[model samples]
Target: MQKRQSAKLQREKGRARRRRRRIRNVGAISRSEVEASTVADPLCLNNGIYLLVRSYNYINILYSTISLLFSVFLFNRPSLSLFILKGKNYFCIVLAAAMSPWRIMMGMIKEKSIRIEKARHVFEAKEEYFIQNGAMLLEKQITCNQGRDTEPIKIFSAKEIQQATNNYDPNLILGSDIATVYKGMLDEREVAIKVKGPTIYCSTELMVDFFLQQVTIKQLISHKNVVRLYGCCLETKIPMLVLEFIRNGTLSDHLHGQRNKIPCQISWLDRVRIATETSYALCHHPTEMFLRHNNLVDYFVLKMRENCILQIVDDVVLSQGSNEDIQAFAELALRCLNNKGDERPSMREVTIELRRILQLVRSRDSKLSNEIGLALT
Candidate 1:
């Protein structure tokens, strides 16, 4: 009876051990399923976050590109810039509707401000000019007793003229004696300032006539080729005449002075053109008057009659033009010097003839160039 009881106790202990082993296996499987679900949830969350960040980066790049393009377009169109400034509130509303970034809208506002300032400056400058123009007109009527039929000439102050001419420095003298011409700056433009000698202003009456003469000269002539009389300063003991500065010196300088000293020569075509232009200028004078000096046309005619025309032409000029062209040019100069003014060709006729001559010469030159090019090829 004791042996049977011990065997039953051992069988119950084995059943209990088997039940504990099955419970341990089920717990391990459940823990593994829970870990897999946790890993899957984290992976899905990470993917969504990455996609959102990438979309934000793309939107930023697109916004930057659009802002750059719009800035470029606005920079070239000043009227559009002005319009934008005029309608800033409207533009702000439009930008807000488009969901424009804060940075881009701020940049446009700054640009609009700059454009408004620039426009204000321009308007102020124009207003100043109008005021000056009105002053000039008033002064013109006071000085000349003339109506407003002509453009008003400026009346420069004595101090302003002195400042421009550096107190009449001797070194700045362009011509001297009867009237001294000095290089000067007026209104930021280079001008020839001619100050009359005290001899001309010996009496008050003579000074008055001199001033009137200047005004009459300015009013009568308005030719492109003639030297322009800009304005004058009459406050000084001897009045000053502010004339247009010709870069190339006077016709006399080119014909017989400084230009002759140089080895370089003037061409025959240029000489003919010069003569033609001078004749045209003389012919167009308001009054008929012969020049006091031995006329240039007469000198050329004398040379032609003496058969020394070649001597009159520069060595460089003789080589370039045809003898026939030179002879024709001399003959035309002679006819211009006819003793009777009525016999001379009109300025209009002279201009037309010179233009015809120039066209013929150019055509000949072009043909010569083509022949030379063919030979070179």
Candidate 2:
């Protein structure tokens, strides 16, 4: 019985010690888990999330800032506007991604609306100018003079002429005087565009009336020597005329103006032919008008009066022209340049005389060529 009680006491002591150790181990484990959770659970997770959110915000801000700067810079420069418009597709994608899609869309819509409004205003202004420039009256007269069967003068749009002339670049200018002439391609055909320049001390109404009359007369006056009037643009304050493209320069430019290294010189035969053709064109003009006086006419009168007209002839004409033919031409020119309109030779008589001179020159040339051929033989 003593041995049994001793053994039982020992066992009880062992059980108490094991239980204390288990309790201590469990408390240590619980404390360690609490400390680990405090360090790693909410704090680490929150800090990592905060860093990620901050980086994302920075990226968004950087993107938006870059987009805004590009937009402002591109919009400010007029020269770069074309580039921006061309690359707008790429820019739109970047802008939409960097900024709010809704805001970007709204801004684009507003810009589009503004452009449309501006275009509408421009169109209305062009229409008003077209009406104010006597386009209606011109159209009525064209219809009346040129029957429905004949094609009337084409009325070109302002945009068409502008595009044709590359906005009237100075480099493409052919001539400038009462009107500026531009060389351009219209409807796949070479055309000369004549835009009247602003004149000083000119009444607007008188100018408009004069321009209207000139256009009407040109439509009625169709001769081989006269440049064909193709069309006109009335969409501007001053109407623009479209004439046939003459590759060669004008007679005045060839005769008196400084030549631009042209290879061909006008021969005496060509001179007489030109005079005949000019008289043919003048025959179409009103016959009852007074003779137009200019410096050339005055010089001719002075030279003829002095009997020194041959001295004033071009070197080419002096070399090839016959004295008799020159005398006849001088007499005809004097008659045409008479100060009194009624005393001057009518255009019909002038044309006939010029033709006779041209025929005589051709006959003389043919005889000379025949004689030269005989000598060669």
Candidate 3:
């Protein structure tokens, strides 16, 4: 009986020990979670701290080196003995130390300004190429559109069109499968001139109707996100559309790294903004304007609906944004890509949602900046 009682007591003691251990583990887990919640984001915090310290150190070293150089110059110079004897050596050293950093800063600013001007000049040269070729046509077109409520859509003559494209220079061609797009000048503006392929239609009437419909659609769309249609040339055997030149090229060029020797890395914020702007354009006039370049955007929508946004996102942009923002954006894109056309959100709704998302991101960034500032202080 005593042996049985002792064994029971031993088992009860083991259970108590186990219970205490479990309790201790739970407490530790809770404490860790609390710490995590209190800390905004460890990675961001650490990065901020590191940058601040690094910049401070750099500035300190720069000033110290400048001061040392001034001291050496003042003490080593034999020709300035009279000036030094006047009790002005220390004052000269102080001036030199202060002016050195200012001079460096001014030099950097001047270099940056020169670079900016060079870039601007390059862009203007591209624009000038178009202006020089279509000077006469531009004058005529401008005269015709003067009294119009909206920008006048001028119909260019075949000769003017030919001259603008340099007789359809092969080098100026942008795309060439079912249709050909040539970079051209219209009304002193850089324009993309799209000409339909001859094999697209068997009947002349059908081709004419298609071109007319396209012209109508282009004329109707005036959204900022949508590319502007300057006019069309119906005088040619195959009609051509004059569209505004978007200097950055297509989104595909940057996203897929095509035609670009140096791949451009698009950031997460930029990707989101692109998606938002695209959706805004797509749903802007869903019933009226059908995009000529709908294939890429449609493909992206399909991939996003499959929850493949993360898979398709460029590697450079993958690490830059919060996952929550990405997921929310993907969800919104999916909604716009819904199979049921009736269930799809309108352009207005998409615009509102995108604006909200952008605001949220900006607020979060501002909050983080404030927190980092406080931490540094």
Candidate 4:
């Protein structure tokens, strides 16, 4: 009788505890949803409207006065109010056009533009970095929090990045070069972060240059076959480059037994696409920064090729295609492999050639749209 009573009491206690826990969970979820909903409400958009109106008023007043003044001198008669009104209207039209959805940046204000300024890479010890401005500067170098001008547009606090990367856990690794990389998630977007400490041979400038070179290449070229460059992080002097995390493992690993299962066979056409894309990047960007998959190439190539040699072909995203297309791609790859950079064709030439090949391949496949270019070639 005593044992039965004891067992019954324990069961009742457990049931009561579970009920209370369920109630607590419901309350927590309700609170979170309320907070999220409040933050996302469109009612807060009045501030943006207020700023936009202020901007319009300022611009109209300045431009209208100038126009009125010009009309008085040029026309030899001053109908100042009418002419000023016309000028204001024109200014308003231009402003509206600029703010239109079709406009690229939606006439974002200085504050908004700065906020939209994406983080390419954030480095620690950013004191060492300086933006080496070449010809194509979409953005100028910005001062880091240290009040020192470092290369890269801006620097990020290390603590902030640490929070984003979850303290750089091993699982965050996307790919490793000389350092481990982490796939970071911030503002709900995926970012590949490569973190490195100050190295003996590499100064901060050199490191920033390395990532900038990568960005430079991406800026010059874009294709489905190449891994895309998002931006880099130089918040710290010891920087991390954030890139598009290719969820698929490297071609070497997939083709070789390095990843898992039997070494997968890469079709000749797919190899051709990869080759073409690699050549395209080189011809367009032209970098001296040669990368070696030192830790990975040989094992991967053995499974993919009988000769077991992997060199420049290792860092590529292989995709499916045809034999003739493959041949043209191979030629381009050979040009990329050319020891002399000067020997490589200009990007303009390479693009023209690729288009021709694509056209030829399209004709063969019947997938080529006649509208793509009757006059284009």
Candidate 5:
């Protein structure tokens, strides 16, 4: 009786063990199924691709529509009589557009390039400034351009800059663009400081590069018309770009003097001189094609002569230069106002031209003096 009872108890125990094992396996399988079917964040990958494709597709469609319209206008499609005479509906538009004005397309391309550069500076800073390089660099030096640096800069305390500007006085405002520019004296030497928005999440390396670019461009640019950049201040957790004090302010301001002047602040000769100087500065890029001072200046002088110097002068003339010095100065102004960047004269050329105008002014003054002396005798 005892042996029979033992065997029955063992069988019951085995049955319970099997039941527990089965439950454990079922749980493991359920967990695996849940893990396998997990959903991902769809917005980043799929959405980014969709946006890029949509943008490119829209651009293509716009260009195609422009092309079609251009063709229709070129064949003078308004006269259906001509279309019927040609005996082809579509070919006329194509042929007319084939001979379409190229200048429009060139202008579009130039505008596009300008916008692309501007957009890169604006949007990339917000969206992708933190994207780190995932690959190894083979080159020793890489191009870096951040507007300021991580290293401590010689920063002016808010108190000091404020005091320099008479306690953040509005009257001390040097320039008013997106941010207010102030004229302040740091280290007893005056500086024009542009206080803009706070430092963003941009790389320090890029700031260093921007500093270098500002320094290099300022140093290499020999033209008198171009503004010089001093070192920038970035230690305040805010990036402050400092530049050389262009006492006269922008050429635009000088050419078109501000509210204080009831009359034009500059004479026609001065206007001409400024324009010529700016043009010359742009054409200073020395290459085999431009040869530093020759080809572009030549073209600039030629076209300017035809147009005359009257176009660029701002309405207000603050002061008149010697009246006798006006015409030659005007002609020089025309040279500087040439439309093509490459065709514009360099600052050097402008300086030379101004000197010649001065000579002309002196000669006229001398002639007038001679007349006075002879009349007195």
Candidate 6:
């Protein structure tokens, strides 16, 4: 009876163990299924929705592109001419709406500001040029020399000069070489405008200095034979000189003619007179400034020294002048052209010598005229 009871007890224990094992297996399967469902459900839904949204966006972009292109194509076609015309009023309305009074005023203000800025820069540049060209020096000279009887140096504006020169018309050009001379009218008087030629060889500083020095020297000189300096224009890069205009051509033009041929024959007496007047003008100023040599003068001096001056003498002069007077004149000219500055005679001495030569020529002419008259009678 004890053995049977033990066997039954063992079988009951085995059944209990098997039932616990089955329960554990079922719980594990249920937990795994629940976790998988929870993870996969939202992932699948999200993937599907993402694909739908992406497809919608692509379709929308494609539609917009096609619509824009189609609209442009349609608008460019001839069939749309009437539609465009009909839309003009709407376009005008839209334009008018966009261009409000405030916007218009702002644009105008911007344009005006630009113009003002440009004008200011131009004014500043002109002022700088004025100062650089020795305006202060000129003013001081004028102030120091001021008197009721004295003629002051006038400062000319660029505009006034332009108008006087007819805007530098080509027809108004009197001559052009190193500098251009223009015929103009200023202050109701006929004037000659002298402007430096545009050249790349010179620098601005050198030109400015030259102009200042020229103005200073010329203003101090007052002689009938010398070209009168009326004023100067400093508005340009190089200053412009306003001079008294002579109706007849320049002395050079009169002596040598325009192209090459002698324009007119000036009698020997007139030539001597002109020379005397010129010498007087030179002597009126300091002689030191007039001692500079030029190629023409050097050639003349060489010929004079060689005693071959007759060859270069003008035909009119040779025909009309006395040999004695010519010799004396030549000697005087040689004295004036001496190589040593200190050895050169003073301008006063030159003037006196010229006057003596003139008297000799005049007395000889008078004696000749008397002889001719007596012989004719």
Best by lDDT: 2
All candidates' lDDT scores? 0.60, 0.69, 0.61, 0.49, 0.48, 0.67
Error of 6 at 337 (Å): 2.3
Question: Going through the candidates in order, what is the number of backbone clashes in each?
Answer: 0, 0, 0, 23, 14, 0
Cα lDDT, model 5, residue 359: 61
lDDT of 5 by residue, 266-323 (tens): 5555555555555455565542232235665566566555764444433343134453
Residue 72 in model 4: shift from native, Å?
94
**Residue 155 in model 6: lDDT:** 88
Q: What's the true lDDT of residue 165 in model 3?
A: 95
lDDT of 2 by residue, 16-118 (tens): 9998665433311122332343344544323221111112234444543444344333332111111111121222212121223344566799999999999
**After aligning candidate 1 to the native by TM-score, how far in Å is the CA of 309 from where it should be?**
1.7
Expressed as tens digits, the lDDT of each residue in 1-377 for candidate 3 is 99999999999999999986654333111223323322434452222111111122334435444443443243321111011111112112122213334345667999999999998986676456335434534444345446454545876766778899999999999877666889988778889988876367457656655655566556555777678888877554456778888887777777767586757676666766776676666664673323334776777877776867788765676677777787787788667655566777778888889977887777777898899999999
Deviation (Å) of 312 in candidate 6: 1.4
Clashing pairs in 3: none
Query: What is candidate 2's CA lDDT for residue 267?
Result: 76
Q: Candidate 6 lDDT, tens digit per residue, 1-377?
A: 99999999999999999986654333111223323333445453222211111122334335433443343233321111001111211221111111123335667999999999998988887777777676645664566457424446898988899999999988999888767899999999999998886463478767666666667767767877678889998877788889899887776777777556766556777778888877776675655545456867888888887988887877767789987788788888877776677878888888888888888888989999999999999
Q: Output candidate 4 Cα RMSD.
A: 30.5
**TM value for model 1:** 0.48
Report how far residue 145 has shifted in candidate 1, in Å: 13
Pairs clashing in candidate 2? none
For candidate 6, the per-residue lDDT at 266 reads 64
